[model samples]
Target: MLTVSIWIASSFMGLALLLNLYRLLRGPDIPDRIVALDTAYVNALSLLVLFGIQQGSRAYFEIALLMGMVGFVGTAMLAKYLLRGDIIE
Candidate 1:
């Protein structure tokens, strides 16, 4: 039933991604949009890891790591901009 579990996890992640997208589109504030984007990134990473495991590929894991790094950087920059109106000092 490992395959079944993987499929279930993938479905859940996909649903989460869609929900996050809705939030991103309709967020009432900058912070809310940023938070939704961060959550979407995390869900994407989990989906990547699951796909990697299912396909026995290491590349997906690497991509997920890179995406995580990018997501963190993006979130930080967005949050800084929201607070100070600029990403650069």
Candidate 2:
């Protein structure tokens, strides 16, 4: 059933998010933390998409798009800051 499939997908995404959180907390370096944060953002996006499917709502899709944009910007800034030690530069 569609509902069962959605539940399973949601469970997997939840697990992924937990793993990402562990990495973010246990990272031995800043870059590792950054990557973990990026991955968390992606997993969160997937959860949002799954919720959108389950609820049949367009708003979740819109929110997911917005989050994806923010995630991209955040990831880029994190990488840039790590490389140059200044995000604005």
lDDT of all predictions: 0.95, 0.96
lDDT of 1 at 17: 99
Q: Which candidate is the best by TM-score?
A: 2
Tens digits of lDDT, candidate 2, 1-89: 99999999999999999999999999999999999999999999999999999999999999999999999999999899889989985
**RMSD of each predicted structure:** 0.7, 0.6
Off by over 4 Å in 1: none
**TM-score for candidate 2, residues paired by index:** 0.97
- Give one digit per residue, the lDDT tens place, for model 1 in 1-89: 98999999999999999999999999998889999999998998999999999999999999999999999999999989999998888
Q: By lDDT, who's the top model here? A: 2
Clash number by candidate, in order: 0, 0
Q: Each model's TM-score?
A: 0.96, 0.97
